[model samples]
Target: MSVDFEAARLASGTPDELAKATEAAIATARGGIERFKKATGDAAELLDIFDEANAALGNLRELAGMIAKAHPDKAVRDAADEAEQELDKVATDISLDREVYEALAAIDVSGLDAATRHWVAKTLREFRRAGVDRDDATRARVRELQEELVGIGQDFDRNIRSDTRTATLPPSALAGLPDDYVRAHPPGEDGLVRVTTEYPDVIPFLTYATDAGAREQLWRLFQLRGHPDNIEVLDRLIERRHELATLLGYPSWAQYVTENKMIGSADAAGDFIDRIAAVAADRLRADLATLLERKRADDPAATAVDPWDNSFLQDRVKAERFAFDSQAMRPYFEYGRVKAGLMDLTERLFGVSFTRRQDAPVWHPDVEAYDVSRGGELIGRIFLDMHPRADKYNHAAMFTMVNGKAGVRIPECALLCNLPQPGDDPALLQHDEVSTFFHEFGHLVHHIFAGHTRWSGMGGISTEWDFVEAPSQLLEEWTLDAPTLATFAVHYKTGEPIPAQMVEKLRAAEEFGKGIFVRQQMFYAAVSLELYRRDPQTFDVAELKRELQARYAPFPEVPGTWFHLSFGHLDGYSAIYYTYMWSLVIAKDLFTVFKREGLLDEETAARYRDAVLAPGGSAPAAELVRKFLGRDYTFDAYQAWLNS
Candidate 1:
C-alpha cells in the first residue's frame, strides 16, 4: 500500500533550494522587464519578454503548488508547501511590479498578431487588478489582503482534508449495497461496517442501501464535514474577499470574480439561472411527484420523502420504469477495460494515440503513466491515479505538472479520482462513474492537445475557469451516446456488449430527474452569488441558504444540517459554482456539432483540434468558439437539453 514519494522529493527540493528557485524566477522576470524596455520597438521582441515572464511566474509557480497539494508523502507535501509560499511571493511581486506594467503597457500592440495583442492586454489588466497602478498605500494593502487570502484558503482546505467522519453500521444495515462493497469493507472489532464519506462509499450507500435510518445517519454526518473549524475560516475569508473587491472598485466580491468571466457579471449569472428555473419548474415538479408517489407506495403513512431518499428512490424508479439502473450497467464497465476503450476511441476521434509506460516513476503504485502520441511521435504524458486511499484528494480532477507546447517538450499531467478499489473482483464502475472517467480524461486531452501558447501561463487548463469546464463537459456527452458507449461497455465476465435494450433504457431514463437536478444547481449558484453580495459582518449564511433553497429548490430545507460547511467548493469555487451550469450550456452546444458531423468524423475532429484545442488560450475563448462553430455561442443548446 505504500507509495514512493521520490518524484515529489526531487521536484520539491529542500527549503533553501526552493527559495533559490523562487529568487531565480524573480531575477529572470526582472531581466525580462529590461528586455521589454529595450525591445518595445518590435512585437516579436516584446512577446519574447512576455513569454519569459510566463515561464518564471506562471509555469514554475503552478508546478510547485500542484506538488504541494497532491504529493502523497507528508514530508514531500510539507516541503512543497514551503515552496508554494516562495512561489506565491515571487508571483505576487511580479503582479505588483510597476516596471513590468509600464513596459507591457507601452508596447505598440496595434500591429501585433491577435494572440500577442491579447497577451499584452491581459498582462496589463492583471497588473491593474493587482493594484500596481494604485497609490503606494493602496498597493501595500492589496498585497497584504492577497497574502491573508492565501493563508486562509490553505487552512480551510486543510481542515476539509483532515476531516475524518465515519458511520458504523451492522451487517444487516448494508443490505441493498452491492456484495462486492460489503466484502471490500469489513466490520471492525466492534462488529459494524465502517463507511467513510469518500465518493466510493457515500455514493453507493445513498443509491442502493435499503435502510432509511442508516441513509439519514450517513447523510447527516457527511453534511457536517469541515464544520466547527472551517465555518470560522470561511467567515474570515468572506470579510477579506469583500475588502479586496471594494479596494479594486467592484461593488461586491461576486462582481470582482465574474467581471472577467464569460458570464460578465454576477447579476447576469443569477438571471441566467433564474431563467433556466422558470423553464424547468414544471419538470422539477414532475420529478419530485414521481419520487413522492414511490415513497408513499413503500410507506403510505410517510408524509414526504426525506433528502436522503432521493437517490435510493430514483434507483428503484429507474429499474421499474426504465428496466435498468446504474448497478445493472456495472458489469459492462469494469474500470480497466473502460479506460483502455477510452484510449481506443480517442485514437479514432482525434487522430492521437496513447501507449502505457510501466517503467515511469509515479507517486503511487496505483498511478499509471502514458505517452500521448500522433503517428508514433510523442505529444505528451499523462499519469492516471484513479483509486481511493487514505488522505488522497477525494474529488475527480486533472492535475497538470507541465504544459504541453507544440514543437517544445511534452506536457505532463495526472488524473486523480477516488474511485472504487479492486475487491475480490476487478472494480466495476457504475455508468456515472464511467461518465466521470471520460470527463476527467477530457481535461487531460484538452491540456495536452491545446498546449500551443507562447505563455505557459495561458496553456493547458489555463482558460477562464468558466470556460475550462466546457471541454470536459462536452466529453461527458460521448459516454452517454449509445454508439460511443458501445466501444467500451462490454461485460467483464461474459465478454458480451451491453444489451441494446439496456442502452435504450439508460438513454430513456436521462430525463427522469433532470428538473430536480437543475433546481439544485440553481440554488448552489444563487448561494455563491448572495454570499459575496451580503455584508459578512452579520451575514447569516445558514439563513441565506434556507431562503435560497426554499425559493429555488423543490425540497424544503432540512433541519439541523449545515450543508455549506461541507461545501468544499466555497473555498475554491466561491462565486463561480454557477460556472458548472454555465459551461454545461456551452458544452451541450459544442456536442451538437459532433452530433451533426458524426461522432467519429475524423475530418471534423481534426478541424476541432486545430481550431478549439490547438490554439489553447492564445485566442480569446469567444473567438475560439466562433471559429469552431462558425457562429456565436447560444443558449439554444441548453434550452434543448432542459426540454429533453
Candidate 2:
C-alpha cells in the first residue's frame, strides 16, 4: 500500500498523466463508498470502511501539493487544480451521504476498545455537523453549500498564492540587508532591487532596511495583497459559514468551530480572550510608550510608532542595549547541522531513532525522507521539504500523506517550510527561524508518536484544533534553552559552538518586545472572534481592524491598507486564531514537567509520549492533559513565564 510519490510527481508534471491519476483516485473512492454502504455491524468490517474511506482520498492531498507548490508548468498546474476539484466532489458526496452515515452509525460498539468507540462517537458528531441528521431537503442544501464553500475557499487560497505583488527599490534602500541576499536578487534594466512579498525577501528587508520609506512600502504592499477583490470572496465566505452554522443549530461559525475544541464553546473562548487582554492592558500601554519614545529619538518629529517601524526599532534596541545581532547568529545555524542535531535530540529524548532513506520517492529534489524507528521497529516515515520554491506553500505545516491505523499501516507525514534556501554556504537560519523549525518538527514528532490508534480517524495530531499547537509550542521552548542550543549551534565555517553568552543575549532579546507581541496576538484573537460573531452583511473588515488595533494593540494601522485581505488565517483557521495564544498556556504548563527533570529527560518524554501524544483524539484533550500533569492543567505556568 506504499504510495509511489516519485511516480505521482512525474505523473503530475503533465496534464494527461494528472487526469489519469485523478480518475484512478475517483475510482478508488467509489469502491470505498460501496464498501462503506455495504458494511455489516461487525467491528472488523466497520474498520475496513474507515480505512478504505481514508485511503481513497489520499490522491487529493497529493494533487493539492502539486497545485500549491511548483509543477514547473502552468498547464499542468491548472490540470492539477481541476483534478483536485473532481476528487473533492467525490469525497464530499461520500461525506454528505446519510446512507453511509447511517451504516457507520448502526455498527454496535458495545465491546469495542476505547479508540474504536471514540471514532464512532466522532463520526456521529461529524455526521451531525455535516447535516446528516437534517431533513432530506435541508440535507441536500447543506451538501450544496459544502461543495460551494470548497470551491470558494480554494479560489481564496489560489488568489493569495498567485499574487505576485512586488516593489522595485534602488540599491540604497537595501543597505543594511546581507550582501549575499542583495547580490542574489539582481536589479533589472532600471537597476532597482526586486523585493517581493515572499518571506525570504520581505521579512529580512523589514528587519534590516535602513530606509523607513522602503520598509513601509514593502509592508503596505504585502498587507494590501488579495485586496479590493479578495474582500468580495471573504464576504461570501463569512456569510456562507454563518448560514451553514445556523442550519446546523449553532449560533455562529465561531461556536461551530469551538464546540468540539478543548475550549468547549465560543463563549468560553471569548471569555478567555477577554481575561487575557485585560491582564495585558497595563503592560501594553507601557510597551507602547517605550516604543514611541524610541521612535522620536530616531525621527525627532515622530509622534507615534508606525507598525512597520516596530521591527527596525526593536533590532536597533537589541544591537544597542543587549549587543545581540540576530543576523550574526545565522552562521551558527547551518541547515545540515540543525537537521542532524534535531534528529539526534529526538532519538535521545523520545527513545526513537531515524534512518535516512536517500532512495525514498519525493515530490521535489530539495526534499529528503527519513524512516523513524523505535526499538528496531519501524514506527513512521517523515519527508522534510524545508526550502521555499517559486509557487510553493507559503507557510510551514505538516500534512499527513498517509494515516496510520493500529497494527495495519505506518503513518507518513511531510513537513513543508520556507526556511532559508542555500546561497553560498548552507542555508543559515536566524535564532527565531531555528525555533520555528523546531516548532514544526515538533508537530511531526507528535504525529509519529501519536499514530498508535485503532482508527484512521483518531491518528496523529488529530486532537482538538485548539490543543494542536500545544505540542509544537512546547518544543519551541527548547530552542531558547542554553543547554539545548549547545547541542546544535555550531558555526558553519569555524565549527565552533555558539558562545553561551550569545545564547543568553538571544534569549534576552526574545523578551525585548514581549508586551508589544502579546498585545498584537490579543488583537488578532479578538479580531477573529468579532469577525465571526458579528453579521458579515453589515461588517466593515477594515474598520474592525482599526477598532481592534486601537483597543488591543499598541500601534495603530496606517491609512488605506487592508491587512485582512492577505490574512490567510481568516480562511484556514477561521475563528480559531486564538488557539495560537491559548495553546501556549497549555504548552508552558506542559514544559514545567520537562524543566523539573531536564530538557532531555527520557523518562518524562516517554511518559509524555504515552500520556499525551500517543492518545491523539482517542481521549478528550482535557483528560489527556490532566493525566500527564497529575493535576488539572492551569494558568500558573503561563503567568510565571510572563512574569519571568
Candidate of highest lDDT: 2
State TM-scores per candidate.
0.95, 0.94
Q: What is candidate 2's lDDT per residue for 1-644, written digit by digit as tens?
A: 34334443543356887787778778877887787788666776776776666565753555354444555466776776677677776766766788888887777887888777877788688877877777878877777777787767767777777775888889889888877677777888998878988877788888889899999999999888787778889888888988888888888999998888889888898898888888777666776777777778878898878888888888878877789998888888988889888888889988999988887756678888888889998888888888877766676788765666678667777888888888664777767778888999999998888876877678777888999999999989888888877898898889899898998998887777777888889888888887887667776877887888778776777788887777778887889899998999999999999999889889998999899998888888888999999989999988777656
Which 10-residue window of candidate 2 scores lowest in summed lDDT?
Answer: 3-12
Reference-based lDDT, each prediction: 0.79, 0.80
Off by over 4 Å in 2: 1-18, 58-67, 70-72
lDDT of 1 by residue, 1-644 (tens): 11232233345355555556667777887677667666746766676667766566555565666655566776666665666666676677678879778877776779867776776687688788788888888888888888888778777777776676899999888999887888877888989889988888999999999999999999888888888888789888889999999997888888888888888888898888788879889998889889999999889998887889999998999988888777878988888889888999888889988888877766677878887888877778778889877666778888766665545446777788978777677898888888898889989889988765765656777667788888888888877777877777898888888887788898888768899889888888888888887567766778888999899976788887777876778878888889899889888888889989988888888888888877777777878888999999899998988888
Candidate 2: give the clashing pairs.
none
| Every model: Cα RMSD to truth | 3.1, 2.3
